[model samples]
Target: MKRARGRGPLSTVVGIVLLALMLFPVYWMVNASLQPAGSTLRGGWFPLHPDFGGYAVALREQGRNLLTSLLVSLGSVVLGLGLAAPAAHALARFPLRGTRAVLLAVLVTQMVPGIVVADALYDAYAGLGLLDSYLGLVLADSTAGVPFAIIILHAFMRTIPGEIIEAARMDGAGRLRVFRSVVLPLSTNALVTAAVFTFLFSWSDFLFALTLTSTPSVRPITLGIYEYLGAHTDQWNAVMATSVLASLPAALLLVLSQRFVTAGATSGALR
Candidate 1:
């Protein structure tokens, strides 16, 4: 047993090193955001004199875009979850004909390039007069969310014992009633996992935001960050600040949904 466990300390050190390497960029961004505007050239390595001006400028300029991102991400989450949950339940429990084929198709979608989807959406949106609209962006962003949510939820839902569902049905509960009342509540961890990822996917989406919205009227923070990078090349501080702000929702969600995420991963692996 001692020989078997001899690698544990080394493995832990390696894991900590890998984690720090992954998070180093975030630390750098926060550090740079605190530096005085144009001081990015000096490479201070630390914020000896932290400045709030960058954040102030970011808020003033990208505030509307931040709100737009929040709305679009939330809309994508609601729409994506609404569509994915029932489909996942059906796919998990029904054993319908061609179920494997359908699941294969959903898996195949994950392999398709986002650019192809964006191109198709742009053409369709132009014809439907959805170009540069909030609805258009939301629908486009859901492309990322729906398939992922379905897979995650389906994996988790499949592990839910069939006996419970049958018990609910034996009590005269309809399929819809059992799904709504019993399946949904029990699938809370999976749902939260799906919601968190869907939110993050939509929130960090730059391609759809770039393609679906032709005007600033519906621009998201991702696009705003892009434009900021281009227009404010000299103002790295503000750009970093905006990036930091854009990351807040994702960070907050990961922190708050830690338990659910852990449960989902374990359940998915077991299923």
Candidate 2:
């Protein structure tokens, strides 16, 4: 028992070290954001005298872009989940033919370069009058989310016991009823995991934001950050501050959905 107890401290130390290494970049960003606006090279390892000017400027300039990103990300999540949930359920529970081929096709999409999709969509959007539109950006961003959500949800859903679904059906529940009441409720962890990742994917999307929208009226935060980088080359603090602000959703999702994320990973792996 003493020998086993002794190993615990070593494992704890290693874990702490690994966690710090992972978070160092975030710490650096926050530290830089607090430094005075100037050449980032002149910033110190830590900010002894924190400055708020960077945040003020970031809020003033990037606020609308941040809101645009929020709306687009939310829209993408809604559309992605609406399409993916039913598809995943069908793929997992229904005795549909060509399931393997369908899954393969979905996986193939992840391999296609984002630039290729963007180029194709740009031409399509131009013809459809969707260029520089909110709906266009949302749909473009959702291309990343939908396939991934389907895979994750399908993996998790397949692990649900067949007997449980059978019992639900035997209780006078129809297909949609069983799915809504039983399958979805049991798949909460996977749903949260999918939603969190989809939100992150849409939120961090830069290529689609750059290619799909030509007007400032619908620009996302990622594009805003790019423009900021070019126009305020000397204001590294504000740039870093904007980056930090943009990263809030991902951080918050990870923290809030930590338990569900762990469960989803384990469940999906077993499937």
Candidate 3:
């Protein structure tokens, strides 16, 4: 019908508008980063002649921390998912007494403010001589990231029926074997989703990294960006440029693994 056709076009226009609104800040950041300081802001909608100098400054001046941030994010994703997957598998298949309560406890732990635990964590890290270290940040980020990974992967694991697992067991596979063979393949989508989520959390975390790591040697890019801003307050161009650069890895990660996200969201909708 004409009405249906018109509705489809209108819906598409609305969706495109919404997407533009959401991406406007990113577009502006990229645009601003391409322009010389104050050039884009000097009464223009976009750069007259876009340049890559901001990106150059961001790389040469701040690339080291970007690498460190990538390491931190990737490390947290691998470690968090490693620890969470088995626990999620167990929680999904053999959920025990008080499991819901424990899940509630895990979710509740996430709600606690970072400031509330900062002092205690600082003291603990200092006692362990982990102050201003990557290990310390990794541990902190893992603690923060685990609960979400567990909840998310557990939900995805539940989407897989128990019969497949039981069949693996019947074929003389042990629990661990069954998990490796039957569950892991189907749950790759969840793993990617959890990794992406965990990476984002660890990548963007400022409070923990800033409080834990005192030096640029181990601090992630988020903290580096803050330091960049503090030291270059008058250099808004460099600051924005650094911010735009900082977001690239996560953006690339999402783009690269978007297929997993689609599969996980559609077929693995957590029960």
The C-alpha local distance difference test score for the whole of candidate 3 amounts to: 0.83
TM-score of each: 0.94, 0.92, 0.90
Question: How much is 98 displaced in model 1, in angstroms?
Answer: 0.8
Better of 1 and 3 by lDDT: 1
- lDDT tens digits by residue: candidate 2, 1-271: 9999999999999999999999999999999999999987899988999998999999999999999999999999999999999999999988999999999999999999999999999999999999989999999999999999999999999999999999999999999999999999999999988898899999999999999887889999999999999999999999999999999977888899999988987897866
Q: Which candidate is the best by TM-score?
A: 1
> Compared with the true structure, what per-residue lDDT tens digits does model 3 show for residues 105-177?
9799899998777777998998999988777888888877899889888888888988888888888999989
Ordered list by lDDT, greatest first: 2, 1, 3
Candidate 3 clashing pairs, residues 3+ apart or interchain: none
TM-score (C-alpha) between model 1 and the true structure: 0.94
| Residue 129 in candidate 3, Cα distance off native in Å | 1.2
lDDT of 1 at 2: 90
**1-271: candidate 1 lDDT, tens digit per residue:** 8965988988899999999999999999999999988857775889988998999999999999999999999999999999999999999999699988998999899999999999999999999999998899889999999999999999999999999999999999999999999999999999999999999999999999888887888999999998888899888899999999999988998999999999986797776
Off by over 4 Å in 1: 1-9
Q: What is the lDDT of residue 214 in candidate 3?
A: 88
Model 3, residue 216: C-alpha shift (Å): 1.8
The per-model lDDT (C-alpha) reads 0.92, 0.93, 0.83
**What is the Å distance of residue 163 in model 1 from its true position?**
1.8
**Which has the better lDDT: candidate 2, or candidate 3?**
2
